[model samples]
Target: MAASRKVAVASVCLVLSLILLQFYVTSLHKELRAKILRAQITTFMSGLISLACWYLYRRLLAENHTVLACPSRLLWTLWKSVVICFLLCAQVTYATNLFFITTDPQWIAMVCYICLGTLIQLVCCLLVCDLIEIGLRVLRRGRQYQQNQISLKAQQTRTVVAILIALMLSARGLTVGLSPPPLKKVTIPMTKLPRSFDGLTVIQLSDIHLGPTVGRSRLQDVVDRAMATKPDVIVIAGDLVDSVVKKLGEAAEPLKQLQAPYGVYFITGNHEYYTGDVDAWFDKLRSLNVQVLHNEKAILQNHKQPEDTICLAGVDDNTADSFGYDGHGEHLDKALGSCDPDQPIILLAHKPSCAKRALQSKYNVNLVLSGHTHGGQLFPMIIAAYLVNPYYVGLYRVSDHAHVYVSPGTFYWGIPMRVFTSMEITHITLQATW
Candidate 1:
């Protein structure tokens, strides 16, 4: 019991120390930016919140003479509270600055967002393991007579397994967070594919998420990968920018290098509206020769021969109007305007959820491409994503005639971790079934 108490104390101290280090780094950033008042406020609030969370955690974990006072009883409450607090902090800060402030917090805000998400996910994982352990114990209750006595060999084996699991998880997180995304070539066989368009190569770059953590250098690598595909068509499904155009314009400048025979196309994701000035990004992309398909359609023909052509249509994100952008909302009918229905059609919508809607529409959309879900971005959360998103991560045939491919994303978003899912540059080759 004393050893367990000592371990708990050490764990708490370690967590507190890490939080303090984050605050110190944030303070230095603020100071460098000459925001003295903001720095002071942040430091004060950090200390206060840290103290309160630690106090609550200690109280909740305290052992007592009763069964109800056990650590497992309060673990859920503690986990939920911490997660809620972190989520609130992240959203409130980002939204407040996005709508109200002229000058963004930049790198400081980025660090906080990433750190908070990482901490929350790690704690959530631990909480889940604890719940599983509790369930196992409950199942074994009253079966003490049936329970096998633990031998030293078994105990040591268990310890080794636990250590190995810890090491593997740590290594995976670091690798996924730090490594550049690799190109994944996927082939799609279309029954109605045009004979002339057979062997059509399309490169998809989605969810680049250029911000403080992911910047020009990373984006350049993605661009290089896309270019290397030597694709006939290049499409940026959505989420090309994580921040406002003014802030990440230079970061996205490498996109000029992306070229394809059929030209490059882009559609706005929900993040575009969230960045506050969606129009600015549209203009910027257009200037870089990226055709913005906002309720618009473009026909791609075989070497400019209009008779052998396929229609490529794109719509604004479904959530555009929800972000207060009225005319910028997704309009499938308008995007599919005057398109040849017999010809195979491809639709680019930001969210994979749009696949069902596309299939429901009269438009003969042969394929829908998307990338917003990020394949859940981390473990266990993928389960949550599955619950919410009809099409969360990969390819699915929405109907006999229509299919949707949800890219895992070209980069990480808020949390600097990817487990089970990968950051990928998707290269899709289309073949005619006939």
Candidate 2:
């Protein structure tokens, strides 16, 4: 109970930083940058040192240095993370226009004085970061995590990923910064689908945020899991690659290795829109024999009879702010226009929030597949997902018109630890209830 209160307090303080930063930006923009940057640098250094300590501590456990990895080390790590909490508060406050520096906290005076004070603060912060880090470890990992024998090498690899991401983002919130991009597999139920193909499984892997973070090894693991199911069709939900396909082009080889009786297909995620050319990824997936389904469309046919079909629809990410749309990325009703409404339809939507409209439009799409959440890749963020996507994770019957399944995802994005959650390679055996 006491610990819960502390976490709650920390969370509240963290949120307050945002409110404060909003004020700082609108009013004290000039004086705020230096103070904030100083805070950031101090936080960054603490994070680095804490990361190093944690690396050593975890590696020690891996090497049977459990005894040598004393409570003291844990204490240091905890202290650092706590300082991280405070800095996160300040940083968010500044980033979001919440800070209101005293009108007299002048740049000329504060810059010089703050520079010297920052130096002193830096030294003190370093010590505090170390102590806080150690204390956090003792309280969190050392205390609660009684059994800790896992892969040291994997832990190290993930740890390095964590540190690099932290440095890149200056995020000390430390709930595992970002999650691996989600894998969306289009599961089309073949049973009773005029296809006469019963229990046909389609392994859908989508939004594979393949970037500096998502590498070949993890992706190959995804392919292996997908293939393990012996899918009849493999449908990529969309946003197959978040950034340049270059980092994951070689990784695409594994995707090419994917085998299904039917075939593999891909669509687009909004990330592809913002970060990479969505059309090019479509071409890339096509080169690998994975059909790219844009607003146009495709029909999933059983090999035995081409006439037997499951109408499949794919669209650009559906967000209220998407550019292609007059407002919402691309409307499914228009995207799926010209479809045979009588036949069952499966739509690949990147953001699950579009479910309400899909139903409202009378598209009558029976099953919708989506995977933007990655079950909050971090942790509490899952709650945020609930704000936009009520079907945050797993299968849910939102209404008579739709059954939506949100894959928790196979790989993680920024930070690899899936605290309270497990990565899923959802082999949804699309079934006809009747």
Candidate 3:
């Protein structure tokens, strides 16, 4: 009750701030009536969203005749979803108001904007929820799968894991969000690269996670920092957003600004699969010249064009049902069936576990870039990432030939904190090996 009151008070203050800003802007630009009305309309929209959520809860889960064990699940889900929407609004509205962007008042435009924005955001929420549910389900299945092999009591392990989860959540409020430190840098030796590709600097970065918590301004700063290095080629491994497509418009704009002649490439992290809109996101990336490698492929020509040829192979996120008919996601073996043995190739797979398969395959890809760990996203959690990801965060010689680099994710998922992890923009150089 106290927290709700506090939020209500804060919301009222936000409305007042909007009004004050409107009055000030009107003084500077006299034809500000439309802007003023737009602010008022947005306020009304906020109230409607709040009320609609409340009514929805009352009708669905909070009603008198509920039978579910946790009827509040529906309400709680909406609550979390709304919080994310409002946070995004805070980011977008503040930026718009600061720049004095013209606010449109056309009823149709307003309706369409609201519908699209809400749908995009809701889709992202649904995406996150789906991944969580699926992960939990998988964990359950994995536990049952090994039940016969286990000699210890299952409850004992469950209790231990539960405590660890609680500790991670608690520590999240403690160590994360610290002025994150600089990214770690190390060089990899490429002894067998083609002579034309020697001393090639390839900047690698992954897991930006832009959304309710991490915003566009922060990403823009990172992008600027990355551009300052002038890398030969920029490769975004995966898990770029902490959240969904709703945040895509705001978050992606910053990434679009990162420029390199060789080009920027991306692959989907598990989060992308959760949203069920990876194809739409791929289309969006193509618009910005960021080549997205689905389990299939794309080609990046060397600067010499004639003398240079680099192939890119991207694998799909490793969900139980990701491949569909593409022979790329789940059926990764098929995706690499047509690799060229003589040419140098770079692969983007979301998880490091794919490294084992990638290493054994007869593909041309020499280096595989991946990020899903976020270095565990929490302490003790990285253990899970390590358990799941064949490589821990950073570069590793998985074998005598294949190389794997796992990025500590780009952003946080739900905790809104970063603990010991710092967001990274990598700068790597490729060399001409004999």
Candidate 4:
């Protein structure tokens, strides 16, 4: 009952938000406003249908009705038919775009600027409008208490301010989203780190969602930046690409240029499993000279002092098992079991939450590199990201002997709007605490 109530409350909030968005569109140009309204309506209907299907499934499960003896049988059949039609239409639309559309870099950039930029701007505008309205109400109340009329000039000024603020934020977000990620240098002092391995620089790149928008040029820029750092090791924590190997293989070609004295390593992220071609991606990455770490460890030793070594272990994304991919699951034990307990270990996990799990386990992990949150990727959403992840972004000291560094991401995903957060190529230098 509590769960049901929470769902009901969430549904109500979603409906109200859509209504507000609909009302907000009235202030937009006619053609754009009409298109946005249509999109919103379609989205709302799809969500409603999905929710109804889930509710019906739950009801049927609770009743243990294996046979179609219930009155909802007919309704269930109708819903299934509608869902199938929707799926078919969606597949056809996607295929049409994929085959017919030319994903030129300039074209993708323009689309992102027009669609994603506008959407973000509208949301910012709505928020600013609401704040202005509240301020006006407060001012009006105070004026009324003093027996004074609210001036039209004051309201007009507030409106203009709101517009300017929204525009500035939107512009900044677009610039940040489109630009190459900046370099972030971090020094981590480890008590157990071998002196021979001191000053070991590792370049960490994560969440480089190469797809239609993030093409070869963008990836090349990232590769150049990482190489410029002159890193001893290069590690991609997770979420390397959004599309399948066939679609993004060319875009990811720049990765082969990455060179380090140690190696370039990669681990699976949740997105890899979602692509349903995890093995294919792994093979592609391996072909690019990237060592795909599947719940495994690599012992790194200094040539001068072979005895002074550190363990670099990587586990699969925590949610990999849920995708039903055979032999793909996060096994921290498998990753760290063979490592020498006396040596400092750096664990690579896609999600920051895994840092806590590693610390709790018997493994003596000195640091964990991850990047799944994308630092919320946008404003307001960052707040929710903080609530969900153990470490939202930046460096975190989880324990006396352990630290976690969560990169914002190498590239923006989906909407391509990054506000109050930046994409980064994290350069970490290991310092001996002796």
Top-scoring candidate (TM-score): 4
Q: In lDDT terms, how accurate is model 3?
A: 0.57
In the range 1-434, model 2's lDDT, one tens digit per residue, is: 99999999999999899777645643443224334544554566556545544444343334423323335877656645644443333323222211222211223322222222222223333344446545645665443334244333334444444434433322322223233333344444332356365677767665566643455666777787677668787777755554444444565667788867766777677656544245556677778887766665677777788777878787767531323323225657656886787767877777777655675676777777777777765434556767767678777776654687776655554333444454566676776644
Model 2 residue 296 lDDT score:
54
How close to the true structure is residue 20 of candidate 3, measured as C-alpha lDDT? 82
Give the candidate number with the greatest lDDT: 4
What's the lDDT for candidate 2? 0.56
**TM-scores for all predictions:** 0.72, 0.57, 0.57, 0.73
lDDT of 1 by residue, 256-277 (tens): 8989989999998876765656
Candidate 2, superposed: residue stretches over 4 Å from native = 1-192, 319-328
Q: By TM-score, how accurate is candidate 3?
A: 0.57
How many steric overlaps does candidate 2 have? 42
For model 4, residues 174-248, the per-residue Cα lDDT tens digits are: 788887789989998887998888899999999987754577888888899899889999999989876567777
> lDDT per model, in order?
0.71, 0.56, 0.57, 0.74
Off by over 4 Å in 4: 1-114, 131-161
> Which scores greater on TM-score, model 3 or model 4?
4
For all predictions, the C-alpha RMSD in Å is 12.2, 14.7, 17.5, 15.1
Please report the TM-score between candidate 4 and the true structure: 0.73
Better of 3 and 4 by lDDT: 4
